[model samples]
Target chain A: MKKITLLTLSFTLSLSLILLTTGCAPDAKSHTGGAESLDSGLPSENIDATSILGAESGIAQAARPDGINPETDVDYSILSTETVYFNYDSFSIRSSERAKLEKIAKWLTDNSGKRLMVSGHTDTRGTLEYNRGLGERRALAIREYLVGLGIAQDRIFTISYGEERPADTGDNENAHSLNRRAMPGVITK
Target chain B: MRSQYDLNSMTKKLYTVLFAASLGALLSSSLFAIEVEVSGTKKIAVQISAFQGADAALAQKIVTEDLRRTLMIDPVVSQGSYSVAASVSGGSLNGKLTDTARGSEVFSRTYSGELRKMAHEFSDDILESLTQVKGFSTSRVAFISGTQGAKELYTMDIDGANIKRLTSDKSISANPSWSADGSSIAYMSYRSGYPDVYVIKLAQGIRTRVAGFPGINSGPVFSPDGQQLALTLSKDGNPEIYTISTSGGSPTRLTRTRGTETSPSWSPDGKQIIFNSDERGSNQLFTIASAGGEPIRITTPGTYSAEPCWSPDGSKIAYSTRTGGGFCVWVYDIATRVAKQVSPGLAEDPSWTCNSRHLVYSNNGSLYLLDTVTKQSARLDNGLTNCTEPAISR
Candidate 1:
């Protein structure tokens, strides 16, 4: 217990040091100026520093318009096992992913407030136009299967990113297999 | 607080901006004519003599580079079968092409106006008269080039000179289809964060989203009359072929299928469209009337084929088909229903010139113009990498 507390204390100090160094830089100070400095006279004693630090870092990382780092922001661990993979030049869902689609359907039923989005992707094997159509078909297939499994159709949205977004950037068969997938995400908005 | 430090920084930024602006001005005005040479062994031999008058050497050099890059003609110093004797008088250029072997004049034409325009006109006229084939010399091809996330549209002359960037959306903008009259280009862009078909007028630089249905709106091909566009949209549950008025309205669905359909190309009469559909398992070429009807599968014996383009004369349909060697350009004779391989390497998206004798396609990242008569393929190196989807405009 003592070791954990000490580690947490050091981590908090380091985070504060980083925030001060980055947030109080000359250019940042010049832009933000006196109003913010005057308002932030003292750190609140009752607040949780970790959550404050997380919120501060999130604000700092708002460079992306979506405010979510495409690489790491979304916790797709829930849908990682439910990912539907497709064959090369084909968008039909393989027979193996049907069980996972059932699980996803049940999960959607449990979490009625959450909306789902299926984004289709493809490998870099064919023409852009063909790949786009293939990607959309893959997404539609997944949506239909989910609908068949009792998921509400109106709660799900589909978008085909084509070969624009790839899970694996390699050109080999293994990478291509990983790239031809339909990813699941929650629509917060 | 207007501190002296702030004032000094502002002045420094202003000076830097001015310096960059002046440098850009200088580059645009002086170095607009890109100096590049194309060399090949199997080239037609010709001699370009020195011209006399203002900007004469520049004009001669531009003409030589232009003709040399075609990969069809070679400029020599002496002992040439054909000779191009040119001279500048006042603001116009007087040029003549003569057959040295027969000692007869092939043609003579006078080009007035800018020196660059004169050089281009002379090259076009010389090529057309000598070879009896339409010259792509002065033509321009708009293509898509950039990294994956930053793909945009760009246009360049056939000689790989005078590159002009058409779209700066900094997003994915591709599949540029030029209108018959070259007044506008219809392309698919994701600037609104969704793939939508947008038409951009070249003269006024106005972009209007012609088709933005619920789902995919791509592969926008203009009709021969430029009154309508045939594209692929997925609003009806699956990717299907649809045709919409160029002015924008409700899109009439053409192909109602459970499989994928894309890459629509119009015939010369604009009565039918040849597109790729995977309804029978593998992507293959299919033809259907523009109004809508049953789609007839055109590819037989081959399971994989895509990117079909019908010739201007409506004689052949060119597409990329995977053979034992690899994916290559194959021209299918509509009359006999026989397919013959035209391009040797991995080539796709064949767009024909107005002449119908030559077709342009992208091999890997470089664009090449293939001469159907001689079976010769020449690389059009515009110094841009990842260039694909070429559309020729008159």
Candidate 2:
């Protein structure tokens, strides 16, 4: 009995020692990783927190009604909103933009024969390839949302322009926010 | 007797555990081993002697500028550690590099081409002789230079000379991929009122429609072997990376993820591809076999990384990551899994020079070179505005 007890005690102590060493290993790795991040000069957080003002100003301009006027030849009011704007580096539909997407969904339902193309775009801030991906996500998010609202998936097509097409030419935050959007266009064929 | 046997078995087990633990430590420590030296940022000095014959001044001036743009060397007025002498006669030029410090001839070669092209060749040869590194002087940078509304494909010499507009499609053109031989460039344009991938053979200026799928056809990159092109297409639903023969056959899908995937860069071995995907909600780097398989995410948490270009040595992946205020060029060491930002400014679209020591990226409508070891960024002087999407040949 004594021998068995001793064995259990030794095993527990050994297990704890191994656990402690293994736990400490990750800490050391994370410490070096933290140092590398600092050394890379890419501060994880915003360097100039004031840059938010520029972005917010851009968002404010996004509220303006321009860039997507209905063609005088067209008779339908299919698009209540010509474009759906997204936040920086995000594809999640803003709560405020949900209603506009619903209207687009209703219009698509009304015109079953018509096809809509959602072309995604991004601000000039991120890498071109990433922005293209982000743009696609934005367009997909809208497509998925419209599909959820009973719009046929076949009626909707999506494309991501990345940063190739920007609605605003300025480099300021206002322009960037305006540029990061998904424009729903009527496609023939 | 039974107790004695039990004790012996326990001892054997303990020895086995000890052996395994030590082996694991040994394996892991070596696996994570990385040697990153913060090397000298100082430029190597080289003297460009006046060319002896025809196109002498032009040849001398371009070679001097070419070396200066390296961000690794400077042009000295007199003799330095290295000196280059060239003689241009007719369309042929002979250039020689001498190591002044050792008073020994390094290399001598004759190149036959245009006046400017011959000078570029000499600059590249001299650079290779001095540093044992391939020079980008003779390489061309294909990029998009225009407003967001109006964009076109433009090619310029690495020294920012010989600005040639390759496309007049009067539509948006983005993501120019240079061929391995530097004879052609492939890019996606909207000339057909939709995105279509086109290859422009530089010498003959012949444009071939390689891909015009039903949906998105963008981010076309030539494979290392030059036989296949990896690009992003949304024809099947979401944007995913696919590989198609440059000769225009059906594309074989590489990534099956529902997430958007773009910017596929080939590994030097042509066995794997590194591309950007938002599988985790934000953009990150992922690698998949060129033949198609499960992808392995390469980047760590904290930043949005994209546009990955694998190094020629396959030791690192140079990409642009979203930093605090802007994007910066960073290199992710494959062995250590450690990322080091090499550019200090807002830079994007990084492509490695053939030497793999330096990368050229665009910052604020201009292109710059960043040395991975020294972490020095120098602007490439082409004097063009809104130059982005820089693709370096070799």
lDDT by residue (A1-189, candidate 2, tens digit) is 445688889999999998887753334223123211112122323222312111122211111012322222222234625588988877778788888888888778787888776778899787676676668667767777777788876766666678877788788989999988988877543
TM-score of chain B of each: 0.85, 0.86
Q: How many clashing pairs per prediction, in order?
A: 0, 1
DockQ of 2: 0.11
TM-score of 2: 0.79
Each model's DockQ? 0.07, 0.11
Model 2 chain B: weakest 10-residue lDDT segment is B31-40
The residue pairs that clash in candidate 2, if any, are A58-A174
lDDT per residue as tens, model 1, B93-142:
99999899998999888899877778888987877776655666667899
> Stretches of candidate 1 above 4 Å error?
A1-78, B1-43, B89-91, B323-326
Q: Give the total clashing residue pairs for model 1.
A: 0
How close to the true structure is residue B152 of candidate 1, measured as C-alpha lDDT?
Answer: 95
lDDT of each: 0.77, 0.76
Which prediction has the highest TM-score against the true structure? 2
Residue B14, model 1, lDDT:
95
